[model samples]
Target chain A: MIGFNTVEKLKGIVVVVGNYGSGKTEVSINLAVNRKRAGIDVRIADLDLVNPYFRTREARKPLAKLGIEVVMPAEKYLKADLPILSPVVAGLIRRPSQLTLIDAGGNDVGATVLASLADAFRKTSVQMLQVVNPYRPFTETIEGCLKMRDEIEKTSKMTIIGIIGNANMIDETAIEDIYKGYDFVKALSDESRLPLKFITAPATLLAEIDTGRFSCPVLPIERQLVPPWIKAAGLKK
Target chain B: MGKILMKGNEAIGEAAIRAGCLNYFAYPITPQSEVAEYLSRRMPEVGGVFLQGESEVAVGYMLFGAAGCGARVFTTSSSPGISLMSEAISYISAAELPAVFVNIVRGGPGLGGILPSQADYFQATKGGGHGDYRLLVLAPAGVQEAVDMVMMAFPLAEKYRNPVMILGDGLIGQMMEPVEFSDRFKSEPSNKDDWATNGMATRNRKERNLVKSLFLDAELLEEHNLVLKAKYDRMKQEEVRYEPYNIETDYRALIVSYGTMSRVCKTAIDNMKAEGVEVAMIRPQTLFPFPIKAIRAAAAKDGCQVVISVELSMGQMVEDVDRSVQGKCPVHWHGKAGGEIPTPEEVVDVVKSFIK
Candidate 1:
């Protein structure tokens, strides 16, 4: 039945922002595609100004055929040092699709650029979400999250709508790691009141969880942001 | 079974399987590394594809490849690593595909520090990647909500043919809470294999669909944009999600917030009410599909004196508050962005100031 998120008619935009390694870009890609499968019109933009590594425009070839529109700085104007501000993005704000995702760069410095779109934000509805990871150095404590939230908001003149507890350990992670992180984030969520969004998981731990107790939604995490290791290991795909 | 403690990250992974998502991919990142670790061991048991990509960039594209095959794929990463995935995310949006992504967010501004921060709010809600598009943003306040969203995300993605996000910070990802997946999942058919590059079908002659984001010409781009716009227009008429807390209260103010931040506001509202300060909160469950109309009603109600926009960041959702108020009443803001959450007492103080 359409009651399932994959078929339900859910509309609106979702932005994925965080510090450099907070995984904003990865979140942006998956969220954009997933929404489309749910029967919603999804649009996306690559607004990162911090690095020159993998970016959305790089995947233009495949995304184009899917029929979803991608908005980015012109190829001719693309540069590592270019100030990412442009009038083109304003048009997107003016005419957002059922779901529009913005994957911003990391840090207060990166998110500060939202001030550039102050005009667009002033004209329409917007919700900014802060992604938090407990395993990261500075973000290990609740106080750390508060500090970062202040820095980003002050820089952009935008308020964070909520907090997303995305704590995780890479390949070496243990089930206990998730349990530990979940407890910490739950405390922060209780204290802050911002909804803790998705609790991301890899496929390995599905058997260990008795999922009936969680109150929020869950999102399956795919590692599409980073390149494949098999290919790097001299293996062919 | 009532409230078994579990990690948010693990719960998310398990919940997805329970929700019927069989494909998983990701790269290792700080704080969220367990997501990859967990999937590597479990995907095989469930007959799901679980591959740990070399870099965050590669993992993102792999999701693209899998999505191209019409599989319910997903990935996760953190701060600096997520920076590497923007390229593929933009492509995913452009393709209007179905998949799920998770960011166990960490703190940073060019690797400034590893910690929690609401800094990514603008990026998540405002189209973080390059495109004129939006992803349905689901902000779960706790582990339970996180589990519910996973079950919901796949169907939502398939129904809309777009990506969906469960924007969680480190706090949520790391936290422990009890969850029940058996009650969370209800199997449904997936359309991925039909066109998702399922080896070749000898019985049929359907074109081998290619999923791409390329629009080399202006006309084609324009057509795609128009089609997307129409879809969005339809969405406007169909989607609006929220939970009104204490809305039945009269007089005073409307406290607006989402995610776990609103919980702070709720405490403040409750505490302040002890001093006879009346306040209502309008919390949105889906950050992207914000409950705008709800705010308007709260504002136009008989005794509401003010609308307060509360959050982890300075005030990203403040603009929405202004829009809902329509200039009738001033919107107030109370937030702690860099990981600080205003105490109930502080929130009460803020709310009391709005008392008529």
Candidate 2:
């Protein structure tokens, strides 16, 4: 059985950062949904000015149904490529909910948006987690993960306190991939001296894999950042 | 290496490298700037050249210069940026240089929204530039196919010594999927010494090669057009590729679609199947050759009553579908143009309209 108590650590001002295509947005959305499902008041700020697509705003309608507030840019500048941060993000940081999650963009360049909000973040006790998908390009190795951590820390001007393992090959993820990912992040946590808060597996695969093997909690991921066609087919993963 | 999750834009960049294309020149555009951003770092690591031109105009010429000297090169841009490159595209086509162009198309006529759209169907399949030249256009429905098509595009471009285009919508540029890079599509660099403008000393030839598209004489221009036309005709006979879905069933409606929109139609067809309404689809992998015979055959199926061109454009590809049907059945158009994609339910509803 997996311990659900470890998820309690994801409260107050929690920020998510990672390399490009490392599944940061997926982890952030699942985190918000996880906390919200647990009956905790969750509000997430979409600080992803770097990427134009697959951001938190795309899930606004569904998130609203779950009563989890999704903060994003204004309607006028919603699709524009410019970096126009909304004041509500600062407002969310100043007065956080039970769990305030900030979904930062991908990479150090994406994380640069966080540096601009340093004043808002400094006022609060923030807990940043770097989601590492070892299957991704940059964070595939321990050295690459360390380099990304340093670059993200330098650009965001915030220190990461924990790691979130999100290794998978999308729809092709297998049982071995989960084990490989867990081992990779476990080693990453040890080398970096950061806590391995949790690792994620597709919700469908949770029944097949033994959750007790993980040293940390296993967050069952229900994928939300998928193309519309996948959603239409009702394929859950 | 095992399959890794990658966005379409980055995968396209890596696919070029795997295809042995060492030169990449591009301008920043929405939905596709990641290609340049990815290649900017990856190119130097691989000891290749990645240049960000002053504009798409300059970038187009950069591709021309690189391809003229027998270098494998490519560029990625959106609709408006592609318009800026059309003139150079014409020159390259007329010059018969081998190069690749990927248009991760967005909504357009002017500066349209940055969301996915197939509105550039006419711009791509037909001549976008002012000339009698045609580009061999390939459209991919998913990220894996996008990578495969990009890898295959270089060889196809070189095979005919002409520019080849991979016509993808914005979703294909932005979406993430697991892609495995394999050696199945790899090809050796073609011998361009016969005609390339590479220095004569490199090939050690006595006669110098001149690369130019200009042919001032009327008869010479006509001859050049016929030669280009012959290559295009060969592509029609040799390069037509498409996937037929649910054709086994006596489908009442045949849907013709391509790129990201076809995936949506697939879902709609599957959904319709559950309700006992059989609808078939013909998804064109190559947009220019267009699988006209396949579409014509699919539309002429025994139970097929109507053919619909379901697209993200405002009835752009519908014209081609109409042309393919050629009065065999009642051809219809269904789509949305304001960057709003038609949902499976919406598609089901649209398909049902033509049913009973």
Candidate 3:
């Protein structure tokens, strides 16, 4: 029916990069959670120095309880506003787990952080994926997506092997939006010479969506990162 | 300006540009980084400068430098980031240089989780850094209001030659809403020829204009302090802004709040009204020059029973509400910190607890 077959194929160090507000962090978190749920030893690292809100570190307790190691800088440096990476990041990269996902920060400035760790990743099979949200600015068109992919690869010193379509507006996201985004991402994939690994849709929209229309696996997003007011509406943590 | 759906963070960025404050220097922080990201691309197009400094601390100084040169400049940061900029904020205030700062506040004390919180209320209102100075603080409640506030902040900062703050929570920064900007604030670039440290040659003067906050002599420093105090007092007399909701009716209770918390309070009040429970509310638009008189009047209205302070912090602004109430009625506080936003139902229950 759907492509767990493709998701099952995900291995080694997987890094997710995209333009700001492209929902890369959301995809990274769900990917880690899904891998762990699928009986894999998952460890996700938050390298998103570009944004502090909605990063994986915020959901540490739940992910940790699920035996998913959420790695980031130490507690003392959490609010330092400096790009201080945890020493454990290199260790995790060197010795890859069953599923090790890295949620990189947005754009070239953020991708540059991954360049220093490039040597450690050289030993392992690394799948660097660019996430595209058609609703966001740079990823909305084919040319913009291609431009972003070039910039991210140049800055991170890693080639993007695949693309992930993660398109949504918080509460207003609908099924058609996901379908529309797929065509947008497909064109990006063709032009950039990369495969679409998966596309994300909120868990609520899954039943209404025709899984057959999509060529890749659909990543059902369990909306973890939300505004405080929405958090109050029974979606806490 | 036509209505367009935009995130509050991005809208604030566009609003600043629309207001003609093009020089922006900021470090990336959650909830507010979109402002910097948007400006980074948009500023170059507008022939303006957008530079991300080493940290929030460095960005604050960059703002001072640019503003000293008579440029309309600003920066955006989150709670902990603002703490780093506090030192520069004090210096800018003392130097009497006009600059705008937006605080898309998140939970804090130290490394507090990145969720919405009003914990920085005291830090923003009472000087965060060491000095006798005040930032003209404006607390916005929603996305459109946030855009308007950022657009208005520039002129207000220039009017007083002081740092103006747009204090909003993560909710305001992250949410999406339709907004349209007008020249309602009359935000033209302020003429800085009188005191700005732009080159003396440009201003047709021989003496070099020094932009600094240092006064080594005690008497001279005291006089400078006095002059700043006079300006602040004038602001107190003329610049207080607030909104009174359901106050025209003889309500049974009054809830005082600002920023994101005020919206929650409004929802609670509306929910209660449907259940035959009417409550008045006082939402302050300006936090420093708090609407003391308006709050007092609201609290003393004919059928009002008590005043309650609703906040995203433990109770930072409650003290201000208490001072405004001035023992006229019993004052209580309800809040949630560490990113726990109180629900409208919870707020309604809290109100019922006291009244019942």
Candidate 4:
């Protein structure tokens, strides 16, 4: 059994973060799709200020077409050098929807934006989580996870509600890899006191794993973010 | 194409658009404000959003909402603003979303001053959030790199589903330099509807989607964190990027730096070359997924006996270097943080001291 669909709906700021190639965007896209499929009004915001390529906001038009409220930086500021935060989000945080997801930049440096929203969080109970990829840097061990958690919380001024264990070996991820990742995140949860929200596996491997064992939930991730290779194919649609 | 002079902030804006990213979110801060000034007008032309956030905090949260819906979102800030954004960065990690962040760094520790400083090294490269995360960090030496990196950042951010940072200092952001555009670089369609929560019609087809970072139970969270660990590991192997200059020489010391600081080191290298100092420099283009292998290999070299970590800060990255060397060679620290950039002559002096 693996981390399966024990959880369908939850509340507060659901965040997604990881190393540069762990498919965090696909997970974000899938989670947005899956939960919305389950009937929850969702508003997703992209917070990454780290890298420019392959950001979730690139999918804004499609997300908007899906009728999902895609909160993002102003296109005018899209290419700005100096970061200019918008006040519109503060109003949203004060009164959250059924589901509000915050997609952040990678690492503590990029994740530090949480501090700016401290006032918004103080106004409401915001549940924060760290998306972990076992294969990424500083995440190979429980200690590394701890360090990462501390930095995020200390910087963001928000407590982490749990962990999202999404482990993959790039496009080569196997079902076994998902299982190993489940155990690893579980271990971190036990040591850190945060709960394990879910385990993610690509749609390709979703069928291979036993869905019964998980105490939390299982997310069937669909990768919409295209690598250069797949962009030209029919996937470009 | 021909090169044209541009500020680091303006370059970032144009480059991000050219990179195929349409959504931009951020808070205003000093020195880097040009980015906001430049983008506010451009967003409307392309049918994009450009909002002036309440604070760095809110902008970060806005980015989170946007990124979760599957969009290319970003923010830019100086030291103080970045400090305010630390909390949301952690949430972004928890959700495992992909986005780009730019830090036009200024001096700090309590808004020390608004000049250039690489002091945030520890915070930036080592995951500035609250969890076991490592953002792919890229330091651009010039305007072209600053712009080019934003183009690369989108795909890289999407490919790994992780945040990638374009890090530089005030000098870089304010300075003007010629840049050449990327070839065959514009985006089309912007087909993002697959998952974004735009309105009711989409949610009607399936269960309403919720983007949250909460887990009530202990066991579930543990299981979740492990998966992130695997992702970080993979990045270490695949995403670590750096630039090695004069590395082929038989040397006694290797100076490691990034962003504006590396340029200073370059000037020193030139002086040392004339003075017959065989010192090499290694600059990490990606600071988060640091070029550890290069550092390790440099430490493993025969004649490369000592490593001197230099930056605009109090040698924070030097600690990582020391960690990388693992005592193979004595990793020394030489830096001046809080807006004090060591001059090229000063860097040369540091090099001279280690000449023996």
Question: Which candidate comes out best when scored by lDDT?
Answer: 2
Could you report the DockQ of all the candidates, in the order they appear?
0.02, 0.78, 0.16, 0.01
Q: Which ten contiguous residues of candidate 1 chain A have the minimum total lDDT?
A: A228-237
- Candidate 1 ranges beyond 4 A from true positions: A1-237, B1-3, B183-189, B193-195, B199-205
Locate the minimum summed-lDDT window of 10 residues in model 2 chain B.
B182-191
Docking level for model 4: incorrect
Q: Who is ahead in lDDT, 3 or 4?
A: 3
Alpha-carbon deviation at B44 in model 1, angstroms: 3.4
Give stretches of model 2 more than 4 Å off.
A232-237, B183-188, B204-207
lDDT of 4 by residue, B1-356 (tens): 33433557878987887786788887777668768866885678777788888999998898889888877888888878877887888787777777888998877788667667787777887766787777788899878889989888887777666677778877778655556676555562243343345665744345554566687788978876876778888888887889999999887789998887788788788778887778898898887777877898887788876789888887688888887888888788888775656778888888778757
Q: What are the lDDT figures for the candidates, one per model?
A: 0.69, 0.89, 0.84, 0.73
Considering summed lDDT, which 10 consecutive residues are worst modelled in model 1 chain B? Answer: B1-10
Report the poorest 10 consecutive residues by lDDT, candidate 4 chain B.
Answer: B188-197
DockQ order, best first, reads 2, 3, 1, 4
Between candidates 1 and 3, which one is better according to lDDT? 3
Model 4 RMSD in angstroms: 25.6
Candidate 4 C-alpha error for residue A203, in Å: 64
- What DockQ results for candidate 3? 0.16
Give candidates' CA RMSD values in order. Answer: 23.0, 2.0, 5.5, 25.6
Instruction: Report the C-alpha lDDT of model 1 over B105-213, residue by residue, as the tens digit.
Output: 6655566333445556666667778878777777777677888888888888777777777777665665555566665444543566444656666325367766777
> Judged by TM-score, which candidate is best?
2
lDDT of 3 by residue, B313-355 (tens): 9998999999999999889999999787888889889998877
